[model samples]
Target: MTNRGRRIGRVGGGLPGIDRLFAALLARIDRGLAAGSIEVTLPGGGQRRLGGRAPGPGAVVDLRSWRALYRLATGGSAGWYEAWAAGEWASPDPVALFELFVANRHSLGDTARARFWSRLGRRLAHLARRNNPQKARENIAYHYDLGNDFYATWLDASMTYSSAMFEPGDTLEMGQAAKLAAILKRTNTQPAERILEIGCGWGSFAMLASGRGRRVHGVTLSAEQKRHVDAMALPGVDVTLTDYRALDGRYDAVVSIEMVEAVGREYWPAYLATIARVLKPGGRAAIQFIAFDPALFEAYARNVDFIQTYVFPGGLLIHEPEFRTIAERHGLRWEERYGFGPDYAETLRQWRERFDAADAEGRLPVDLDDGFRDLWRYYLMYCEGGFRGGGIDVVQVTLVKEG
Candidate 1:
């Protein structure tokens, strides 16, 4: 038996009346399943295949303890996922297991009541984690200050952490470069103009822009990132550990990549206003960000899933209609927009593959504990699933200040 299989023999949690509970759970699963198959191996040696799709394969999940069932029945998707992460159940094919849940939406708590409460909970969660200026700094530090070495394991040499523009057979590095070039082109940046990047990460784009002999100012809250940019010592690039809210002076062009999500919904007006306040007349701006469709935005906000809790504390996604509303409110005219969800999904796949390989070779996890690694894997895969499932998208928008 495999280690996971052996685990089933020693774990506990069966009461005299538990057999009824197990039977009912199995019966409900059997009823709910329509396509795809799930083979459940209960503790102490009884196996049951509950459902199957005619030509597709299924997953084999070995429950090491009765806890997995309780969590699934009571806690919903979060509980079920946490149970897997906790080792209460073992599935050699995790993606297949997730697919089974996807096939049977009820298994992940897709009831109307669940949906209602989920939206309420997500709104509350976002408010609780809202980014006031000080909280914003703390939140940025929490995710970005994990040391340059950690991100270096998964990100490309450019250290660009946002979604990339990709083509078939394109490498992650090439896609990142493409994203940068696309943003610069959309803004119509010129070497004689002044450029301001509101969330310059590690100065990758800033350095690239400065190489064209333009004066580039890249500001961010991440001190470690500032250090990296400073080390580059690019004469025309000014990288600072400063907040965009504190910035002053006019620029010929502006750009921010995937940073608005962290600005919080309540502060979006201020952020957009700041862009308007600092840009010269007729100046152009380009921003790349994660966006959602408003139809599902409310439903999505209600869930406030694992990503919000552990990865980006103050982040909140915005949809396109909402983005246009706020931009128009602040007098920023939207010129063009492009969606890059599939590209982001592909970028994440590459990162996860590289991370797994590096860790397997003992190149990563230098000081990170086992739980941290698990959290990162979950984060990466969860975001990848979100993009692949079409729950979210990344967009690059060209805006003009009535120029």
Candidate 2:
């Protein structure tokens, strides 16, 4: 019967009240913000204040269900994210909230406890979700195969699924086009070279590269993506629905856009070897991916969160140095590294806004159902939060095989 616990209506512990949970959660949050505000409204409509900071430029959160508080209390960030997706909570300023979270990410308590049971629990969750080839395909189909028509409602004209380069004075369409051009330029798609693109989404970059005076073969596991690519029926662009390891023939250049994240850590050696093995002598390869910083890579890699549970299963982001080291071991020298993290944050913002607007207006080409929509919402925003908080970075790396 601690005084603080009793004050929070936690007498004898039937189930922790909102006050006790809120107070505990706020203690963690207090370490992160530089005097910010989060005015919380409990499930039964009672209100509580976490900080003394006022509300004009702050965030308001409504815990619509008891599950929200319970999960967030027990699960930390992963749990909070689940509650958000489950519609257990609402925030007026999600981006700002994300910023605050990220600003203190280094201090936040997402880390699994040092105890054996806690570490074991995390490892088990990760082990269960590791992306083997079959599991990889399942995960790919889970997110990418969600209907081309569904994505058509919000994606830019290019229909590029990866992050776009949002340059100054550029529209979303222009940003996507610029990203494609940047990839092609990095790979030096000139002199009628034969090119291989791993994980081509909707053939946006592949089709564009084909017209760049190069023969492009795009490989993907998503039937929907292959169908969209095939429907274009463009010459010099050969699109196939198959795994990258199954593909044949060497190429003068290779380009992959943010596809490595889905490759899974267990397949990193094979993935790097594939690109290194297939490239002609002196060929250049452009591989873009989202990566965790080296210092935080091990910690981040150890856990599976909301993204792993509902979105990209078997998806893992490696460290930058890990990419360079692995590629170098496979006989590829890293020549350039391009950071597009901010651009990715912006790109996600645009996609989410479009999706939100379309859902509001009932203008979606097809019904996504509420759960699916919320899943996408969490996926996009979570990644955006990762980028904004400097927890991750987006990169297009250039590697060269020695002649």
Candidate 3:
């Protein structure tokens, strides 16, 4: 027997009552899934089908051990990931399963969420990783400072990390260019007017804006990113290693692409306030962000997910309505919002393909292990599935500072 199989035997040996509990839990999942379906092959050659009530994605899973379900029940998404890493479960296409779960999140309710004690523990752990200035820099380094070469292996030539705005027949590079153009247009700044880019990733927007005869100042917390940007030496652009809160100069426009998500929910007000403070009166700030459905925000905030646990330590998806309210409070008028969730899904799909190809060709960083690669691949698929499910969305909005 494999280690997972041996462990399953031990768990099954002295746990008749717990086995019944696991059965009940599986039944709850079946009842909760209002859309799509899952074909499950259990240990000991048992088979069970779940969901199938409505038309949606179909998935298949092989439960290597009942401990998988137990971990899921107690640890939520993070626990489920651990179970997968431990080989306690196997799925032919885990992305479809993620999509099914997110698509039916409303009906599924808390069926997939962490229990009280687990939720409390995870929440506390997340809070400890909060984005105070020092911690914020650490969090940024944890993901972005993985070396520019590491990202260049998989990302498009521009090294844009956020979701690209795709059009029919557009390559990843073209889509990213489109996104940058759209954001720059939203700024509506004259050639001579100054622009500020917060969390500039490798200076894509800065180079684009500078090429157009606009002076651009880009700020970032990641030293690696700053070094990369500095090396470019774009004549009309300057890159600084600085926090948004420490920004001093006033600009005619500000553009932040998918950066607000890094500013913890607690710091959202400050983020908006900084935008309002730095923008010249009547100037616009273009922001691209990912937001979770308002109805599900409360529950999501209560439990730490896989992304928060492993990928981006201090990250939180925006709750749009509340975020809009906060922007208004900071005297920034939220306007001209555009959502392209399907585009983000496509972007993720293409990125995953490129990442897989890089891995297959032995082009990824040599220092990174198989485990890290697997974690990253899983993260990409999980995000792609979330976008496909439609509960989470990517949006661009212009926030004009009130004069």
Best by TM-score: 3
C-alpha positional error of residue 398 in candidate 2 after TM-score superposition, expressed in Å: 0.3
Better of 1 and 3 by TM-score: 3
Q: Give per-model TM-scores.
A: 0.83, 0.88, 0.96
Candidate 3, residues 1-403, lDDT tens digits: the string is 4222222223354665886677678778888888788888887766678888789989899999888998999989988998999999999999999999999999889888899999888889889899999999999999999988889988899999998998899999999999999999999998878999999989899888988889999999999999999999997888888999888779999999999999989999989989999999999999999999999999998889989999999999999999999999999999999999999999999999999999999999999999999999999999999999998999999999997
What is residue 97's positional error in candidate 3, in angstroms?
0.5
lDDT of 2 by residue, 280-315 (tens): 988999988988867756766765656765677777
Error of 3 at 284 (Å): 0.6
Q: After superposition, how far is residue 106 of candidate 1 from its true place, in Å?
A: 11
Q: Clash number for model 2?
A: 0
Clashes of 1: 3
Q: Looking at model 3, report the run of 10 residues with the lowest lDDT sum.
A: 2-11
Clashing pairs in 1: 118-302, 119-302, 282-403
Candidate closer to the true structure by lDDT (higher is better), 2 or 3: 3
List RMSD in Å for every model shown. 5.0, 3.9, 3.8
lDDT of 3 at 114: 90
